[model samples]
Target: MPDPERDIASRYREHTGRKRTYILTGFVLLVVTAVLSIAVGSVDIPPQDVVRTLAGYSVSTNWDNIIWNVRLPQVLTAIVAGAGLAVTGMVMQSILRNPLGSPFTLGISNAAAFGAAFSVIILGAGSTSSRVGDAVTINNPYTTTIMAFLFAMLVTAVILAFSRFRGTSPEVMILVGVAMGSLFTAGTMFLQYFADDVQLAAMVFWTFGDTARASWEELGLISAVVAASVIYFTFNRWKYNAIDAGDETAKGLGVNVEKVRLVGMMFASIVTAIIVAFLGVIGFVGLICPHMARRIVGDDHRFLISGSIITGSLLLLSADTAARIMMQPYQLPVAVLTSFLGAPTFIYLILKGRRI
Candidate 1:
C-alpha cells in the first residue's frame, strides 16, 4: 500500500499554506485600499506625495494638513472600527452558535442610539448654529458618547443576567435582544417626537455613522479597547473552537462553556458599544465579514479571526472612501453606504442557505 499517513500530512500542510496565502492577500489589499482612501479625497494628492508625507518627508503644508488633520484620522477610524466590529461579530457567532448573532442583531446598536438620543433631547446636549447655516452641533459630545456606552452596556448586563439567573439558552437570549431593540427604538422615537427642530436635527445627525468625527484622542481610546479584545480572543481561540463543537463536547474537552460564553459576549458587546458610541451605527460588516472569512478560512478560530479582521477592514475602508469621493465636496455618511452594500449581500447569503 502507499504511504497513507504521509499523504494526509501533505494534504494538511497544503491546506494550511493556502489559508495563509489568503490572509496575506487580504493584508495586501487592505494596504492598497488604505492608501487610496488617504490619497483620493477632495484635494487628491498624488500617491508619491502621500507616501512621502507618511515617510516624514515634507510635502506642501496644505497637503500635509489635509493628510494629517483631515483624512488620516478617518482612515484609521475605519480600520479600527471595521476590525473591531468584524471580530466582535465572529466571537458572538462562535459563542452563541448562531449564524445571525451580531451587534446589530443583538440590539446593542439600537440601545446605543437610544442613549445618544437621550443626551441630545432630554440632556439638551444638541443644538443648531444659524451662523453655520443651521449645521447641527453636539454641545457636549462627551455626554452623548458616555450615555451611549452606558446604555449599550446595560443591555449586555440584562442579557447576561437573564441567561445566568433564568438558565435560558442562547436562542432565548437572542429573543431577549430582539425585544430590547424594539423597546429602545420606541424610546428614541418618543424623545424625537417631543424635541424642537434643532434638537431633532442634531439627534438625526448623530445616528448617521461618520468616521470624521473621531479625533486622535478618541481614536486612541477605540484602539486600546479593540487591541485588548483582539488579544483576549486570540488567547482563547482554542476554547472557542471547542465550544463550536457543542457544549457537551466542549465540557469534555475541559472548556467552561457557560463562563466562556458569558465573558465572550461581554467583551464583544463592549467592542460594539464603543464603536457605536463613536462612529454611530455602521452595520453589516460584523454580520457579513465573519461568514465570508469562515467560507475562506474554515471554522478554525485561529485563521478565521485573522481573516475576519482583514476582510472587515478592507470592506469598511473601501466603502468609506467611496462615500467621500463619489459626490466630490459633498460627502455621504459611511453608514448609508454600508447598509446599501450589506443588505443585498446579506439577502443573497440567506437565499443560499448559510446555516451556522
Candidate 2:
C-alpha cells in the first residue's frame, strides 16, 4: 500500500531541491563568466594575473592599470546592469501578466535615450569633441544621467496616469507603453536632426549601450539603487507570486494589486533608467532573460528572480566579452552583439509557438 502523504512530501522535496540546484549552478556559471570577461579583452591578461591584480598585487604597472583602471570596472558594470535589467523584466512581466513586457517594450529605453539626447543637444552637457570614441569619456555624465532618470520617470507617470482611468489591463498597459515608446523615439530623432556634428556623434555613442563608460562613482550609485530595489522585491516575492496568479485571485488572497503594480513599476523604472542612462540602451537582456529564467525555474518568483539575475549577468558578461574581442583593436557596440544573440532566439521562440 502506497503512503500517499509521504509520497507527496517526497515529490515536493525533490521539486524544491531541483530549483535550488538550478540556482546554484547558474550562479557558479555567472562567476566564471565574469572572470573570463576580465581576462579576455583587447589586451589579453592571463586569468591568474587577472586574479593577482585584483587582489592588490603588482602584476606589472601596465597590467595593473589595464585591470584595475579599465577591465574591472567594465566587468562590474556588466554584472550589475545585467542583474538589474533581468530583475526589472521579471517584475514587469509579473505585474503586466504579459510575457513580452520589458523596459524596451514599454518605451522606457526610448525615454532614457531622449533624456540623454536632451542633455547633449539642448543642455550642451556632454563632450563637444568630434571624436566618437571619446563620447563615452565625457566630463559631466551626471547631467545626462539625471536627465535620463527624469524622462524615464515621466514615462512611468504617463502610464500610471492613463491606467487610472482605463484600468490596468495587460493589453491596455502594453498598448500605452508602445505608444509612449514611439513618441519618445520620435522626439530623439527630432533632437538628432538639428544637432551639430560633435553633438550628433556624442548622442550616437550614448545610444550604443557600451559598458566601458562605467566609472567607480557611477557603479557605486547603481549598486546602491539596484541592491535596495532587489531587497524590496525579495520581501514582496509572495505578493508578486499571488499577483502572478491573476488580479482577481491575488485580490482574493488579500494582495493589494494596484499598490503592488504601482510600486513595482516605479522600482523597475528606476533600475532601468539608471542602467540605460549609464550603459546606453542594452536591449533583449531584460526581455529575454526573464523568459529564460521562467523556463528554467518555473513561475516561482523566489527562484525565478535568482535565476534571472544569474542568467542575465551571464548573458551580458558573455556578450560584452564577445564585443571586446570580436573586432580586435576596434570594439563593436555591446548592444550589437546582444541584439545579434537575442534576435535569433526571440524569433525561434515565436516560430516554435513558445509562450515567449
Per-prediction tally of clashes: 0, 0
Shift in Å, residue 253, candidate 2: 1.0
Q: Write the per-residue lDDT of candidate 2 for residues 136-222, one digit (tens) a residue.
A: 444468888889888988998898888898887777778888999999999999999999877887788788898887898998888
lDDT of 1 at 188: 98
TM-score of 1: 0.95
User: For residues 286-310, what per-residue lDDT tens digits would candidate 1 score against the true structure?
Assistant: 9998888887898899899899999
> Clashes in model 1: which pairs?
none
RMSD of 2: 2.5
Determine the backbone clash count of candidate 1. Answer: 0
Give the residue spans of candidate 2 off by over 4 A.
Answer: 1-6, 126-139, 351-354
Candidate 1: list runs displaced more than 4 Å: 1-6, 130-134, 352-356
